[model samples]
Target: MDRLAGTSGFGGVYGAGIARPQRGSSIVIGYESALAFWRRSRVEDPALTRELLAQLYPDDMLATLDAEALAADTSLRPLELPNSPFERIHHAALALGLREPVDIVVGKDAARRRSPSARCHVWSGPVSDGLLVGVEPGVYICSPELIVAQLASELGLYKTISLAMELCGSYSLLVNGACEYGVPSSTSHSRISSVLRLSDSFRGIDVAKQAALYSIDGSASPRETVLAVMLSLPRRLGGWGCGKPLLNAEIMLSAAAARECSRSSLRADLLFDEADLDVEYQGREWHTKPEDRTSDEARQNALMMMGKSCLFISREQISDEARMDGIALLIRSRLGLRPYRRPLSTGMSLRRHQMMLDFGLA
Candidate 1:
């Protein structure tokens, strides 16, 4: 009798003392059961499947199957399944042009059966349909709102807020009656607010709610989101406590003026309308090109010609805590606000410190 094939894409057969099939076609039992088992286990990526099996199973058992020969034979493989929630979110974030790291929530049943690993985290809490997005058959992921909630539960307040800001600042809302990927609308703030209200009973909902206040839509990058949060967070929590600033605030230009300035419009990364202060984050990755640098200089000059004060924060400046403090002090001094008190030392909480590192504040 022919032995049953294993469920992995790295084709192989299983069972003890089972003879290889004769010249005729093989009779495979449990084919449907094996497929269902793989799908339920979230073993979607073939490459990841190989890695997991190698890590989890005994070498002698693996050696029994001709993994290399099976890998070369495509017909023996299982059907390719949709990615796990972790991978789905990562791809979704990339599709939506977000740069923040994606966090995931593993169901309790799956977590209980498998050993913890870095590939995905175990979510030891309740889950419901409202929190998930079913993208394909047997594939599930957290919706954007639930993603924020999971981050809040796992990463704490500051990092969660920072991630929420990144999401709102970079991506538009996912509403119906639009394209498959959805249209770019300025509904991130409102959508997040609604999510907070709906998820009020979820774990870590309080922190998620508080974090929503600091998030603004229309941010262009992760760094820009962090910069906005740093400036707007209250000083009591070691932030600059500056009033909320508009992100990517537009400066309109007439055709003639635009032609003369060599641009159509100016969108300040962070704009304080009351103080007329424009804070820009210039990362080396995007600003290293000579043309990019020249264009930036010209844009700054144009803003200056319009009587706007501009502050350019480089990657270096923001990476250093002392330099960021100085920048905050300069802004406060210019706005005629009270003297900048040295940002209170981040309290002696290990979790807070980890959060700071995660959000790149450290």
Candidate 2:
């Protein structure tokens, strides 16, 4: 698994456990299911992905096809059990005592009826070169990039960027899929795709490519992602134009600072390295006890001693335009950048206001 993670060539399919296609393999999971697989993978076992991949792709396929060529070949993939992928999955779920809707993807030309069972969402399309990742022999899921690309048409710009952040963010959506009489289930999975793998010319990735350009890595939560996007985007689109900061970047502390703060290092929610400043997004997740405040003060004192400025922003301040602007002013002052004096255009003001409320903090 370490070797698998270490390899740069395999991409997210390997993370989801792509296997070589065999005689009766079916392409089962895709779309929301594929997205769900990635979010679930962060907590699930890499072994699951691995085993599924092994099941999908027969090892013997490599004997004739080179590794690269084998990965590129999607022709060996089979239809979903002679006819209906949706019904096939529904029956399997019933056997397993599960009841969630199953999403199935098929090639653009694959034969599918008008509909399937009540619990299926069918998507037919021409998948990109690296889209399908086999987990069980012939079974596949859309890659993370492909999933985002699929979503781009629906998500627009800001939402697409937010999706990118969430996909690569610290917290997983964490679905507990266990259901039924006595079937045992647990949570787990792996990281198989990233924004870096986004393609410019991919069929459905036109908007996602732009989102990827603004997307940064290592966001801890949705709030942090909102802050990053809000502060990093250009002013014309309702942002402070603070430029992208390092989200959840670790900063090693000096012995003196560590001694005072009682820690050797600190992980800032957002860090502007050039300005020697750190912005902390103190959302509802943080405990508000007196001791927590005391500890936070100590850390702040440590940063002050180190000659680094730290600004704390809460959800309340984030929602208030005046308060957020004050914070931005303070940040720009510290960054040695000029603040905007001219008022935003009416359209820009509306866009900015909408952006603040757009992110689903809940």
Candidate 3:
């Protein structure tokens, strides 16, 4: 392939009356060079190569080359070929050693191309260099900011921000083994802002901006982030519109109080200080353990005794619309907000409806 750039083009090499090899004979002399060239280039497919060869060469000309011998050539090693950007991103993430699973662009055609063992959830949007980080050669993955923006596009303003908070922590699912991805906690906010700036003209940029406005830097888990967003998002966006709350806010305890509680301090997942509200999200994975359940119950009781009203949002409740609506109403009532009145006709745009559904607003 490289030699094609020289004065002796493919035509020049063959037009010089070069002798043809036997039909079933191996052409091993330049096999390594050809294999190296193919590996360094794009993906390889024997069928596609044959089709192209048939187009470029006469049938008799192609018949002289041994297809079986070419295919069985040990000089050509197998190379990994990713079928889509998602696969490329997965490989790149592994190469870069990212701590959390980053979101990838999955356009309208994704359903047709989806595989059973896909690693990342797809986002429907335009993907460009602005959204990807190239790690190893030919491996491109979404950058942290791009990941946040993509999440915003799919998950809406509130949830995306909350996700950013969770991703900002040291521990993320993307990292390998016991070690966590060592991302700086403070970088989450700034990176989101930077991404917003770069993606000013991008589709769904408005939603990304809105999510960034509510994103805080400290969320221990995805459930916690969702709970915070649900509590703080405005009613117009299909949320209760409660005031923004501190996330993972610590409650100091006296030595005697600590002894009684068997801990020196407690951190509320979401805390509305003025309203004296403490919200905790108990995902089935963590809260199912007996020890965790017991500790959580004790913590709730302690918080209640301290004049703080506690709301425990379960994983099931989060998934159920009726329960979520009830929770929303309860939060509004506690925050002294008026009862939510659904519009007679929402007149909602298709984009808005999609965004609402993506953010769990619906």
Descending-TM-score candidate ranking: 2, 1, 3
Q: Give the per-residue lDDT of model 3 (tens digit) for 1-362.
A: 11111122222221122122222121111111121222222122333322222222222222232333223321212212234544544454454333223332333343323433232333433232222322345443344455566546556565566556755543343211222233233235544564465335545678788777777666666566666666676656655567688877898766655665688788888887777788888777875599887887777666766767778888778666568778877777777878866641363334335434665556
Counting only residues 3 or more apart in sequence or on different chains, how many pairs clash (N, Cα, C under 3 Å) in candidate 1? 1
Q: Please report how far candidate 3 places residue 226 from its true position, in Å.
A: 2.0
Ranking by lDDT: 2, 1, 3
Every candidate's lDDT: 0.51, 0.60, 0.49
**Highest TM-score among the candidates is held by which one?**
2
Estimate the Cα RMSD of every predicted model relative to the unseen true structure: 17.5, 6.9, 18.9
Quality of model 3 by C-alpha lDDT: 0.49
How large an RMSD does model 3 have?
18.9
Over the stretch 1-362, how does candidate 2's per-residue lDDT look in tens digits?
11121122223233223333443546455566666665655445555544433322222222223333433444434334344455556564454333356566543444443444422333433342233565443455665655666677777778878877776565655457431121111110122123223223434465666677777767777778888898888888888878889988898888899998899999999999889999998866566677867878888988887889788888877877788788888877777888797888998898787776667532
Worst 10 residues of 2 by lDDT: 179-188
- Model 1: how far residue 307 lies from native, Å: 2.3
Q: Lowest-lDDT window of 10 residues in candidate 1? A: 22-31
lDDT for position 311 in model 3:
82
